[model samples]
Target chain A: MKNLTLALAATIGFLHADPLPSWNKSDSKQSIISFVDKVTDAGSPDYVAPAHRIATFDNDGTLWSEQPMYFQAYYIFDRIKQLAPEHPEWKEKEPFASVLKGDLNSALAGGEKALLEMAMATHANITEDEFSKSVADWLATTKHPKTGIAYTDMVFQPMLELINYLRLNDFKVFIVSGGGIDFVRVFSESAYGIPPERVIGSSIKAKFEIRDGKPVVIKTPEIDLIDDKVGKPVGIHRYIGSRPIFAAGNSDGDYQMLQYTSAGEGPRFGLIVHHTDADREFAYDRDSHVGQLNKALDDSKTQNWTIVDMKKDWKIIYPEYIESTPSQ
Target chain B: MKNLTLALAATIGFLHADPLPSWNKSDSKQSIISFVDKVTDAGSPDYVAPAHRIATFDNDGTLWSEQPMYFQAYYIFDRIKQLAPEHPEWKEKEPFASVLKGDLNSALAGGEKALLEMAMATHANITEDEFSKSVADWLATTKHPKTGIAYTDMVFQPMLELINYLRLNDFKVFIVSGGGIDFVRVFSESAYGIPPERVIGSSIKAKFEIRDGKPVVIKTPEIDLIDDKVGKPVGIHRYIGSRPIFAAGNSDGDYQMLQYTSAGEGPRFGLIVHHTDADREFAYDRDSHVGQLNKALDDSKTQNWTIVDMKKDWKIIYPEYIESTPSQ
Candidate 1:
């Protein structure tokens, strides 16, 4: 009698275990389940072949915590400081000087031009191999300002589960982000289980040349492609050459990408991860400077896109880390 | 006694089934087989993991015949005439007018700039979807100038075998070509079993916008990345994000790509297809107007790269097509 009861309990447990444990049983979670089911179901009219089951995600806001500021922006700031000794002119320059002094507001005071100048100083004139190693080193050592945890640890627990679930259902997951491609690529394969080739993003130009009878890629400051807003769909068309069946984003930058994916033939899924947990994470959206989600939020309702209210929809905000402490 | 005789005959036939029937038994063929064996052998020190087994091929002259003129060049020339009715200026234009008059020599007199002008007119200023459809439609209807066979049928049989052989050994094959990415992608999967995502090449700028409340990609005339010579390595780095163990090409355009691949840390293989079979195919190399193979030909010997002599290394030049007729 005892053995039979144990077996019955085990079967029940297997049936009840949630694939996305961090995600609460809300309509947002329900929509995800329904879409995956419809696409994967052999009997369903919306069944898509595994080859065509492409799912793209906005990395910075959708996959991880882009709060405080974008994570890559933090890396770039550190790079500016590290590269200051070589570029003495940066000490007196407006943007680089501000960056060095830890005054971000003053640095970004000049807007996009200032950002590009800072980026060029730190991101270019180095071999690609060197740049990649620097990114890897920073990712290994850096901690999130608010979380007091490794930046990698700030990745949302729920998003990880969702990615795994999609992968299990034979969907080819791709990171189509506005972040620097090389920067995201260093950590993406290890952190998010997305390969380097599958990640697409903004990139600076790189020149290939033979130096001392050896091949080396020299990254130049010239902006190659800005893969945000209108550029996302173009990047998708250029790189993947196929329309994604599922798209996820958290900002207006992803508006066109979502629009492109949803407009494709047959059933498509669009999702937004709305920052609603002020206590655990952030609360601002439309007014926030980083990852502003204004037009996309309003469009979500009309488009029937699932909006995950992080406070109610996410049972947990981030992965547990050794140094993490709850805000009092 | 009869059964024993038959068994002996079958065993003899099995030993010489010829995996690459179009390739003659030569050092070039031996080098390819040896490299593949070394990389795939689990016990060998040079053994590469399946994920890292990337092999890139240059498409035009390497995989298929680019004789007389490039097959796509023919397509572009035909498009100029087809589109001439809409643009009255083309009737008197230098390159366009020369193209319409069937004066190939005068059309190419201005060189690369003239080619770019033609490409921008026919290859851009339309939706990517529409351009793809146009290429597909042309491929379906058009035949090669001399062969009377579909252009797709002109693919080199030995190269196809080599691609298949690499795939069988768990290598992921990619096409890194000077040709437009979209143009190669249309037939790559069907002809070579390499998907669109696996092909990287030159591109023109594109814009994403909402048309009639629907998102679409509009190709612009501006050049993006030119995937030739030095650009090949840059494209490979940007797309694959890893150095290929094996690289193959047929001209000076692929010199840097071969150099990049051969310079990697591990045991690398570089092979060049030298067109030498004048009887079976066009044999111009050093003095050829298209796919000029001058400097790289000298570099191949020093680098120890395999140079495949079409006359000596290949038993057949092209794959037999349904309507293929021997050139009289």
Candidate 2:
């Protein structure tokens, strides 16, 4: 009878313990567990096939930091500085001039209009292959301004474990963001273990042709697709064909994605990662400049979507400090 | 001296006998073995990461027979006849009139131009979900005209084995074809073990909106994308965002796919399935009305792509028959 009592206590302790030791079981962590459990429990009639199990995550804030300015915007700024000698005219351009002068705040002060101009100038005219190479090269050397770590390493450790866990269970995980597809494709494999092909994001218009006896596709300035908000569902339908059973996001931009995924028939899961830990991480939601998480919070309560309090659930923020070697 | 003589005689007898028991070891089979050896052997410099391994295959000829007409065309014809009662005007229309009168040859005599009309009439206006269900219903009952076997059973067995082998090796295989995405998505899983999300194909326009307090994306008649021939590479780039490392095709329409895949700066593999067994299956290429293989044949020689001789490499065509199943 004593042995049975001890065994039951041990089982209860294991069940309550963090299933993912790599993750810090904060509020964000709890939300992920609750959502995954509801969708993955076969006994509850919510079990999904390994094939139908798909989870799409927004990258910038949902997976990593997108503080004062977007991470891609910083990448674009650096790229402009590096390519300034090649295109002297950029020094005199409106947004480019501001960016070159080290005034990103003023450059993007005009909001979407200025951002579009900067994006178009930097991203256009190059072959898609060249753009991919450039992004890869930049990511290899560039470090985040605050963390002093490579931008790639700044990804949330808990989120990375969630991604791997979902994949282990046969879920086809994808990164769907408003960021350029080429930019994210570079380090997605090394950082998130999500292959380049599985990452679907924004894209520039491109044309396929044979040049110098070699086939090449060139990225043009014309906006082909913007994968955000309503565009998320459209892009998902266009690329993935089937509706995802699970979705995770940290901003209002992801509301539609969660809605589309949760509204589907059969088992479904939706989660919103609320950045509530200011000391360990940035904490801004309703009135934040980047990655606003207000509308989603209201929707979370009404729609019964799991809301993740980042500070409470996560025991650690990044994987690097957890072990001596970062790669593991 | 007598014992040595006996040993030499035994060695000679062993050499005279065929080494491979089940396989015929024809040129086509040898090519497959050589390619798989180079890619899979870790000792070889050509070894690739399972994650980076991507293989794309054309559908109509590579997977199944597209003889008298594309099997989907036959399905559309049957669909038109079945759905004709709802629309009395379809009986009076030119293409529909010819289709209803059982003069399929005359109706499709105009070729692609006539086929487009039939496709548009049969596939438009319904919600994407409704259209998918319709396709599923059709496939459940549809049988091939010649062998009286279900069309799904007509899928080539050896090719199916290749798909499974590639997947086992961590290759992310995709089906890039000109077929309607919805139609192919219906039966691709049961036939090829490829889920709907991995199948990238031609698409009609769709619009997303809230209907009856719920979000729904509706399909439209306007052709949005065509994934065939030159368009195959474009579709692959748009949907997958990564160049495939290996490609397989059976016709000229897949030429660009092979070209785009093989053109990547790495060890690449390209194979063309050449139909040469008229006794067991239909064997028309080059000048064939459907699934022309001329351009691919010409490029295969120029580009040094492997050509798979159906009669030589495959002991069995379809999976249903065990008598002709290849041993290895």
Candidate 3:
């Protein structure tokens, strides 16, 4: 009788327990659970090999917040300000002039042309080690404009839980993004449990050389590769070789990656996060200047890719007390 | 007295015992030994953290023979011949025409431009899976023109032992090659014990889509990314962001990779394989059209990189016939 009563209590506890407590049970949550259940249940004929269990996530909006402007862009802006004393000429430079004026809108008004100028000026002429240190220093102190939180702290806790859950099920997760390679690598391990090597992103040219009896590599202004849109699939093929079986994205920029991942043989999953709750978090998707999600939405129904409703799926947004405590 | 005799016998056996009996230690053998010893010995100051134990090898000359053109090109030539009847236009195509006419020199006369055309015609319009199968089928029957041995059989036994040795010491060994991604993926695992996903190489475009209620990806004629020369470091950064602590190469093309590997913080090893024995194997460098060693030789001296004198360290070149043959 004692054993039967203990077994009953255990069963009741298991039934009431939330599988993904860190994530609020929303439509996004349901989609994740349904997809994971479908793929993980061996008895249901959806079991996948550990080798084939590859999951790719977009870095910016999908994994963290990319509102107002990209967090890395802000990091670059702060970097320019910090280095301003050494290079007084940057005060008179066009984009740098606007940047110093605190008018990022006008500074980036020229789009790719202006952004390239800013990137070249800030990312070049330094040894990779120096660039890494500069980035680390900037990220350590930089805060998001609206939330008054550290840029790193703005990451969605639900996504963090999702990453952990996928990894627990033998999934090899990779960050495929358009962000700078070194920039993402700085915090990927601590924040996402993804080591620097597994993070694939845009890159600038680097030169090999020896300095002070030790070999060193210096970053060059020349753009080596752009890992975005069509480049995503190309990057995945070049770096990863095998197509991913699962992909998560929050914008149209990740469409190709999701397409490539879902197009592979056997069980596959493609998920798109829809930011529709303004009270809990900022809400803007289709027409958002940063991470536009329009084209992906149009194809979501046709492709049968899962659309995660942020408001319905998530019980919480960022981690508890994230607004008070910086992520770094 | 009996115990002393037993101890003497044990010492004699230890002195005579070959640790890697399956490997015919050649000139490149000693460098491999020195590298492994430095990196793997816990007592050595050169000991590296398991995470820092990243090693990369060039596929063609470093891992296997690339003489008479890269083996993958030979595989493509054979593929074109096998598929000749199905594609009538191939008969009149410039490179394909020369290839079909058995004029190897003329087919590759235009270098990468001509090679790209030949590759596109031969590889396009097939699903990625189908292309993999085609490569697997070709490798099974294809033999090296010089040795008349299976292409897989031409891999240096010493290098094979080195790969296993490094892997056993917790080193993450990766193949960063200039060969076609699909071409290398077919045999990398069976030949080198490297899974296809870990192989980074040049690639053509591929498309993902669902067909017949199942996901499938199709290879396209578009040139995606080429993994060669300076492109090697770019590929490495994009795929494996961590700077490798050890790099092995046989040509000037590998100079940048070696430089990049050795440029990382902490202990590193860079080795260049010098082909100097015409008796045991083909010997040509500096002026050689393929695998030029001139630039690398100068850089190796200037950068303090170790150069492997193949003639001195190796006891044998290829695996012994008896060793390679199947057990009775």
Candidate 4:
């Protein structure tokens, strides 16, 4: 009888030591565990073939905090300032002048077009190698405002655990983001364990040519594809060539991707990361300008998507900040 | 001593049974084997990490045969005829009329523009699901003209062995083709063991919308992207994100892809399948109307790209035809 009690205690202890240590033992966490268990169990009807076990995650708020505007926006703002010296007329220009003058809201008042112009100016017309190096250099030096930590160090501990868990279960995880492809690719592998090839995101047209006695692929300012909202599903179709079996996102940008994935003819899972912690992390949902979760939040209940409330569902948020490799 | 002798003789006989039975003992085959060995060997300075061991192959002439016009061109012609009763105006059209009248040469005289019109007509303006179904239906019934065998059965045996060998060495093989994305995806898995997610090809634009109380992504008639010539490298960049380490093709349409791949840092490989066997397969290059191999053929020598002479290198062109499954 003592031996039986000891065995039972050991089993209970093992069960409590779950894979997602940062996630609180909530129903949302349970749902993720249960779904993974069902899909991985070969004896169960939900068993998916290893090759088809694909899971995609949105990179911005879903993987890291997107508060105080997108981190890439800050990069673009800094880029505008850097280019201002070359463009002497920028002191009088509307968006560029405003950006250089430290008025971000006015610079963004022109909406997507202004943002796109900034993205094009900063992200294109250079060789692919130069752009990659610039992104890596920026990521190495940039820090989040509130946390005063490197942007890469602001990755969610819970999401990191989830990625590791999914990979362990034979799931090939992909980063499907609205951010620039190169921007996301710069640190995705180091921060999220997702390699550059598996990342699907917005792109600018690139031209392959021989120049200066060397073959080079150059990124042009022309927009090639967008991977947001309705475009997300289209991007997934074009890049992945198949719908993902699992998807997770934080905003309406990922609504269509989740719809496309869940609509597939098999058991699937969708997650919405709800920002609900005001102390540890900024909390905003319906009214937030950046990473707004409105339509997706409204439909999560109807669609049976797990709404992961940050305050309630997470025992820990970001990993302990560490700038391991200093490049710049 | 007799038992040991017998064992030694059996080991020697097994070793003599070559892995690539359809490939003759030629320089091209030796080059492929040697390159793969060097890259895969852990002790070698040329060793590449498993995740970076990407290999891309062109579909048409490189994998099978694209002799008497592309197989997809025949499918488009058949589709034009099948839809003729509905669209009576097609009978008076130059390209469509020529296609229906069985004058393939006159039909193709209109060149790329004419082919684009047919592709837009038959391959788009329907739901993605419907388009995929139509491709599958056509491939299920189609047969090669000379072999009278199912098109899927015409896959090259040596290429099959090479694919298997690469997979064994942890290389992720992808089909980077100029053919229709949905069309290649249908047979890629069954014929080559490459899943739909790994196939990258040309695609028409698709948009997501709600219809009949169900959401569906519909294929639009507008040409979204082409995956040939200079566009091949663009497609590879937009889909794979990372440049492939190894690339293979058989025509000028693949020139940019091979250049982009081989230009990358490290021990890269590029291969061109030269169609020199007129008796077994069609042989036309430099001045050929279809699968023209002009500039690429000339550049291969200077670029250090291995050119596989089909007549001298391949002992067997295609695998023995066998349709294991009946058409739907």
Candidate 5:
């Protein structure tokens, strides 16, 4: 009788368990739950087949903190430092010199052109395997500038739970990011439970060749797809070959993606992660240079997109680590 | 006693059932079974994880009949006839005029440039959904000129079983074709059980746009990736994000794909479908106008790729449709 009582209690606990434990009780959380329920329930009018249950998430600010500049920019800077000794001419090069001097503001003063130059210099010529290995190595040793935590660990706990929640409901989740594809693929599986094949992002052109009697795909110093803004929808059309029923983003960079997802036929869910928490995490939007959220935030109400107030909606910002305190 | 005896008989039959019933007892069939067994056996040294068991197949001649010109070429010609009323200028245009005149040789005399023009004319401007709808309609109404069968019905039965066999072994099957991605995606799922996301092929540039308050992906006239020959491996790298453990193809277009797959670490399988039966199917290889197989055929001996002789290996060339007989 005691064992039966314990078993019954355990069954009830399992049945009533919250999927998104980090998310507090709010409209933002309820919207997500209700959306999943409507789509997965066959008796509901908004029932979507398992094959059509594709959910896309923007990586930079939506899945993780993109503050203090994009994490990939830091990777490019680190790669420039690692490859600096070989390129003596880089000492006098404007962007390279500024990057080496540790003046990120001055280095980025040239804007997209300078960033593209640095990215190509470090990212191209090597085999795809080598490039991914370098990214994995840098991620293992490097720490975020402000948080002093591993970059992968800075992923939003609530968002992770949401991903798991949707996946549990038979949604095929994909990361449609503006970040480099190769760089994001290294940790996507370990961090987000998303695989490399499901990652669609910006990329450099690559060529296949036989080197030393072994096959290698060498990255070329040419831009391929820039999967940001309008390109996000194009990337989705080309890669996923279907419209996502659910989309999530944190900034205007994902404005078109949210627009496209919400425009799809049948029941659709669009989520905007508004960084409203200044105490728990860095909070800057609208006027902020990186991850500007003006247009998407303003249009969220008109678009029927759910706005996630980080400070209010989320109970925990980041996953708890062994060494760090909640205050950190 | 009867029930017990019948149950024992059914169990024995299930255990000894042949996975590839259409494939004759040949080295080609044995190689596939052995490779699958080696990779799936947990106690074997050559075992590969389920995630890494990716098997890619070329579409046109490898999976279906591509003898009387390419199948997509036929689709282009049909589309031109359907849209000829919109552009009266096409009636006098060189290639278009030849296509309208029913002179295929004259139309193709202008070579790749002429083919590209025809393809772009028929394929571009429409939304992706519209494009796929046209492909489906064409497949439904059109019949093969020589075989008098539906295009989807032209799929090789042996290859179909092989795909199913690999899928049963937990290998993810993908259609890596030289055909247009959109065109192949229309029938990939229904015909081969390969979904749109698993089909990687040649593509034209497309843009995401909003027209009349609806989101649409407009196909552009310009080319994106060709996904033929060397481009196959590049597509595999960019799309699949990893080298396939098993690769199958028919022509030289798949040479690099076979090479790349075989060169990967650990056990790998490469197969070449050689059409050698004039009575059963068209028989032309090294000197064929389409699907030239010279280079890959010669390299197969050194690469240790299994060669499937269509006539000798396959018990049936095509599936047993309601209207078709074994002689077909």
Candidate 6:
């Protein structure tokens, strides 16, 4: 009788518990909950089958924090620095020289061509294992410039709760990012509970080769898919095949993905994480060089996409804050 | 009391049941079972985590019959015939002219270039929905020229059982096909119990477009990925991210994938389905127009890969036979 009573109490507690605990009681939170509820409810007209309940999230800003610059850019810069002694030509090169001088803006000034050159030099001409290990090592040792926190710890607490909530409702959540596919894959599973296969992102060409009687996949300098802007939806179609019912992103990079998600027939949801909290997290939009939220932010209103104001909607910024703060 | 008895009996039956009932008692069957058992056993040194237990199967000859020609090729020819009225110039075009004359060999004589022309002409320049609907319609109406069986029905029953068996043992099954990614995605779920997202294959470039206020993905003529030969490993890396522990294929196309899978530092299993039964199924190896099993066949001896001789290993071929032959 005691066991039965305890089981009942546990069930009730679970039923009443807030899934997104880090999310403040705001319209953004309410909209997300309502959409999930309606779609998951079998009796509702907006009901979605579990098989079709795919939720894709943009990585850099949507799931985690991308401030000052993308975390991947830091990785690239660091990688260039590490390999600087070997490549003497890089000291005088446009992007590499700028990167070494700690002038990120000047490095980026050379545009996509320079970025691709650096990405290829650092990311390619090595086995997939070696590249993965290097990324993993860098992430383990690297810290954000201003926050002084480990790069992985900078992930949004509210977004983590949202991902958990989605998964609990049988939604297969995926990270569709502009970041390197291989780079994100290393930490996706450990950080977000998303397996490597579930993470889709920009990639360079790679080929299989036999080295010392063992097969190894070598990353090539050639650019393959660029999972950004217009390429987001293309990546979704190529990787996922099926259209996602729900999509979340930050900045104009996510515009096409949200557009594609909302365009699908039946009840669909699109979410945008608008960084509005300057004190808690970095706040720059419209004119921000990295993760600029201009066209997506403006169009969110017309598209009926739920715009998440970080200051008002999220009670907590990072998971570290939750551990530090005492519960009432 | 009766319900309890039935439940206990069901549990016992499940524990002892032959997962691959279609597979005859052979070395091939034993090897597969042994590998799965060793890897799944918690106390065993070779035990693999469920997360890493990925199994990839080649779609065409590995999962279904690709005899006479690939089933997708048939779809292409039929599509060309249906669209011929719209393209009068196809009457004089080299490949198209041969296709119109019902000469498949001549149509294919132009090789990959000719095939791409026909594929793009029929397969592209339409919305994804239209293309999927057409594939569905074709499969529903069409029958194999030789066996008069529906294309989907031509799937090997033993392979189906093997896929199910792996899934039962906590393996995530994926279809890595040389066929068009979009083409295989249509029936992947229904035919092979593999979801669209889990199916990786050759693809054409597509872009998201808002046509008449509705968002639609339009397939373009541009080829994006060719998931064959060395391309197989590249596709696997790009999509799966992690190397599969278990890999199955029937042709040289899968050679690289198997090589990659086996080279991984773990207990791995590679399977080659040798179409050695001309009476039951078409037998062509070393030299075949489609799904040529040459180098892989020769190297299998050294690779320790289990080669399934169709005649000796499979008790039943297609699922239709199982229905016709009633259990004693």
DockQ of 5: 0.73
- Which is the better candidate, 1 or 4, if ranked by DockQ? 1
Model 1 lDDT tens row, A1-328: 9967755543443344467766777788878987888899999999999878999999987898897888887888999888888889988989889989999989888877777777777888887888999999998988888877788877888898999999999998999999888888888878888888889999899999777768988889999889999999998988888889999999999999999998989999999999988898888799988899999999997887889899999878787553266532
RMSD to the true structure for each prediction, in A, is: 3.8, 5.9, 5.4, 4.3, 3.7, 4.5
- Report i-RMS for every model: 1.0, 1.5, 3.9, 1.6, 1.0, 1.2
Per-residue CA lDDT of model 6 for B256-277, tens digit only, reads 9998898898799999999999
Candidate 4 local lDDT, A1-328, one digit each (tens):
9967755543453354467877776788889988888889899999998878989999999999898889899889988887788888889987888998999999999988899998998888788778888878888887777677888888899999999999999998989999998888878889998888788888899887887866677899999788899888877777766778899999998899888888887789999999999998889999988888999888887888889999999977887444343324
lDDT of 2 by residue, B1-328 (tens): 9967755553442333322223245665566555666777798898887776889988888988787789889988998998899979987887888889999988888788788778887887776777888988887887777777778888888888788867877789999988888789888999999988788888887666677787766777887778888888878887777789889998888988899888998788888988888977878888888888897898787787988888876766777573244422
Candidate 3 on A1-328: residue-level lDDT in tens? 9967755543443343345765544555667766777777777677787766788889998889888788888877777887789989988887888888899998889886788778778888887768878888777876778888777777888888888888888888889888888889888987888877778888887765566765556688888668888778766765666788889888988988888787666778899988888987879988888899999999998877988878877767888877456533
Q: Which ten contiguous residues of candidate 1 chain B have the minimum total lDDT? A: B9-18
DockQ of 1: 0.72
lDDT of 3 by residue, B242-301 (tens): 689888889988888888787666777888778877875678789887788898898886
What's the lDDT for residue A99 in model 5? 94
Residue pairs with backbone overlap in model 2 = A24-A314, A24-A315, A25-A313, A26-A312, A26-A313, A26-A314, A27-A312, A27-A313
Clashing pairs in 4: none
lDDT of 4 by residue, B128-203 (tens): 7777778789888888777677777778777888888789889989999999887798789988998887888888
Q: TM-score of each candidate?
A: 0.91, 0.89, 0.82, 0.91, 0.94, 0.93
Ranking by DockQ: 5, 1, 6, 4, 2, 3
**Residue runs of model 5 more than 4 Å from their true location after superposition:** A1-16, A321-328, B1-16, B322-328
User: What value does the interface RMSD of model 3 take?
Assistant: 3.9
How close to the true structure is residue B173 of candidate 6, measured as C-alpha lDDT? 97
DockQ top scorer: 5
Count backbone overlaps in model 4: 0
TM-score of 4: 0.91
lDDT of 5 by residue, A197-255 (tens): 88999999999988877888999999999999999999998888988999999999999
Writing each residue's lDDT as its tens digit, candidate 6 over A15-54 gives 5567877776778887888899999999999999998999
Query: Comparing candidate 5 with candidate 6, which one achieves the higher TM-score?
Result: 5
Better of 2 and 4 by DockQ: 4
